[model samples]
Target chain A: MARVVVDVMPKPEILDPQGQAVARALPRLGFSGVGEVRQGRHFELDVDDTVDDETLAKIAEGFLANPVIEQWTIRRVDA
Target chain B: MARVVVDVMPKPEILDPQGQAVARALPRLGFSGVGEVRQGRHFELDVDDTVDDETLAKIAEGFLANPVIEQWTIRRVDA
Candidate 1:
């Protein structure tokens, strides 16, 4: 089996309230120096060795990420 | 400034319904050969150069992840 990692992040133009909440709470929690936080989604897929990169990309784009508001990257990782 | 990436994943024993939903939908969507899908959270932090690894680790563990149910890994990445 091959392992594929897909990272989906909100588009740069989008507002991420969850990330902003973290950035705001950091200073109050005694952790400083973090300027901005952007939260996103990560997916790990266990696929058969026969599954090719194109198929993985299709799965990532068509299923794992929403193209309208989010962007995604796909890469094969060591199993 | 430096970029820090924090990946938070549910503990292996925890049920991931979101991931399961995707796994179940993939085959229905005409994609096959994918055995399992695990979904998690990804965070990108813009931090001052002064923020040390120890502090970043604390931020990831104390805030970004629920120690009781999730596990996290922290790494510095090229900006």
Candidate 2:
């Protein structure tokens, strides 16, 4: 088995309200010198060892994510 | 500076509709043997060198994430 890690984030031009809110609230959380906060999601997916690159790309685009608002990268790691 | 990695995932019992959807769609995307898709998010935050573990824990809880539906962990890495 192979492990795939997917990190998904909002497109740069798109406004991220959650990230903005986090940035604004961090200081109040007691870190007086903190700067920006960019929020995103990380997924650990277990892919079959035999999967190919092209098929993985299609999985990423089709249902693995929402391409309009998010970008994802997959890295294969030891199972 | 130090780097912090945060991985946010829906609590195990909480329904991850998006992840479930992805799991179902993978087979159609030509990954015939794909099993599950538990999607989450990852973020890398640069922390100042002076930060202590206690303050970092506050940052992880208060503003760095949503405690109700999400859980996050931070790791210090070289900047």
Q: Give per-residue CA lDDT, model 2, range B1-79, as digits (tens).
A: 6777777777877788888877787666556857666776666666677878788787777655689988777787676
For model 2, the docking class works out as medium
In the order shown, the candidates' DockQ scores are 0.93, 0.59
Docking quality of model 1: it rates as high
Task: Give the distance in Å from residue A17's predicted Cα in candidate 2 to where it truly belongs.
Answer: 1.9
Query: Looking at candidate 2, what is the lDDT of residue B38?
Result: 79
- Per residue, candidate 1 scores C-alpha lDDT tens digits across B1-79 of 9999999999999999999999999899888899989999999999999999999988988999999999998999998
Question: Could you tell me the lDDT of residue B45 within candidate 1?
Answer: 97
